[model samples]
Target: MLLFLLSCFSFIIVFKSSNLYEMVSFLTPKFWIQLFLRPVLKNHASFELSKLDDFEMSLLDLHDLALDQILEQLSPAELCSLAGVCTYLRSKCRSNDMWEKHMEKKWGRIIGNAALREWHWYMANNNKRKYSISGGNNGGSFYSICSWWPLNLVFRPKLQRKSEIKGDLPPDSIMAWYLSLETGEFWFPAQVYNRENGHDGFMLSCYDAKISYNLKTDTFQARYSPHGRRTIEENISWSRLRTPPIDTPPYNLHISDCLDDLRPGDHFEIQWRRNKAYPYGWWYGVIGHLESCSVNEDHCICHDSETVIMEFNQYAPESRWRRKKVSRKDHREEGNEADGFYGGIRKLYSKQEISMWKSLWPTKVLN
Candidate 1:
């Protein structure tokens, strides 16, 4: 009986231990948490996979219209880079329709009819040379309308005004102006200098001048409104420059007899050999339309009869003017500088020569 009871107690203890293990397994925190989160985690993973698949499909199988819409937003440089990626892209990029659209958008207003004709010629012969839609050329056969040098304007102060002043007056200033081919506007870089009384002097502070270039005449016309401050005076200061009356004749007409090869639209600049104040420096006057040119046996006379003159007091700060060595080639070729005023003529065909003369001036483009 004692052996039977001992065996029965051992069996009971074994049964209780097995029951406790089953209860613990059902109540475990880790087991229940994992069971709840598995379905949610699997659904999230599937959604992410679907999103990735859609992205890949959109890029690889986009419609032509969609692709074109995307490409339209890219710049010329960006389009060129994209064209190199594949054969399909290359064909799209080389489409004449696309090029014409780009040209019209970028330079339609800036280029005149003559320039547009030139552009059409370039496109027709595109196979012979590399052309860019943004008016840049990769080869020698093409010239872009946007690449031409802009017309420049110079203003010199009149010395007589300062001489007539009684009290302490502000120093005189010089201005170099340029016309924007795109906007048909006149602008110049603002210059800052210290006044004699330690005040700030802002020269050419106003920019209300409108400019237009006539392709047929090769002449520039500018009109200044009565708006904007022209000077840094305490009171309103108006611009001293006055546009010549419209009735003025062309400068080339006067000298056409002397120069048999005179062409319409040629650029003319007035230059004096000697500066009135400083005899050593080159005195350059405003560039104007060449109304007439007359050459006699003794002297050559070219007049800018239609030129507008800006009269102001002459101010030559020590830092304003610098002496540069006169080229022996220029001096010998041009002959002795005329005493009063000389016309420096440049033809459109001689672009290199024109650039060489323009390089002498410090100011080119203000904007």
Candidate 2:
């Protein structure tokens, strides 16, 4: 009798399990989850679990030196992103030492002491005020000048001028000038064109002007040396004449009344306006040196003949004058080259054009 009852109980248990399985198989996945799995997961989630301690150290937890080392490996964009993560990172990112390192990496070789001072000023005041001057569609925007080389100025025929002249423009109408530091001269690009075929080509030329900068007034005063002026006639290809080099000594110009708080490394550029209505393009150059001039009280002029007037020497070639050929399709793209050299034209008319120019001058603190 006991064996018979045990067999019956085992059979009942097996039958119940089989029924349960069949019921689960018949139910949809959603119903199965809601009825069977939800309660188990809910109970498990109710228990508070400690976070893992083996994760990487937070940036704030690292030693300052280690933190700096990590930051040094990061690009400027990454550093900025890290700064945005927390206040602690932001403070570390803004360290003058870090910015100086960045400046050195990007511009140290090309910039001089004056340019560095100007950079310091920019760092201190960039957030407070934009370090730019405003004017027409193509205003005379100043950029940080490279000290080691001269600045190239390419003057293309103004569209308005070209239209007014019915395209009968003089060759001098489109001038290529170079500001050289080694020669301390401002003159046209030493380019000789191959006139045999009517196709235009490039040649190298050397010319410069005597340039002075007034730190107190922030003005550049320039006058061609007797010899420098004469070279212009020779340098003009249309004139078909070569002249002797100017032997005249550098002269002095008093600029104390034109500048205010001028320092080294400050880059100044000028753009000639076709009258007051149309600004053609930019002429970039650098302030090479500054010397205190003895003021003549009688005439309110600087009389120191020995003083080197601010040497507004030239440095680098302008981007437009580069030998690279830019396509019209490339110009249509929206980016840095908006104000860049496009088919030898500079002044852009629409907001899109001005934005394109402004985009070209963006202060990139990164490589």
Per-candidate clashes come to 13, 31
RMSD of each: 29.8, 29.7
- Residue 152, candidate 2: how far off, in angstroms? 45
Of candidate 2, the 10-residue stretch with the lowest lDDT total is: 146-155
lDDT tens readout by residue for model 1, 1-367: 9985785576457546654335223323333334454556567755543333233232215577756765665554444433333345545654554455565564443344433343355345443442222232131212121121110000112212311211110111000001122222222111111111112221221111233433334433443333323323221111212121121122221121212232223333222222222111112222222224343423333232223221111223232221111221222112243332232322224465345334333332211
Residue-level lDDT of model 2, residues 1-367, one tens digit each, is: 9985785576557546654335223222333334444556556766332222223333356577866766665554344333333335545654555555664563333334443343345445433432111111211121111110111011111212212211111111100000111112222111111111111110111123323322223322333334311222222222211111122111211122223322233333222222222212232222333234234345323222222222222212343332221222222211133333211212222464234223333132111
Question: Candidate 1: where is the Cα deviation over 4 Å?
Answer: 1-53, 58-60, 85-87, 96-127, 130-367
- Output the lDDT of residue 187, model 2: 23
CA lDDT of each prediction against the hidden true structure: 0.30, 0.29
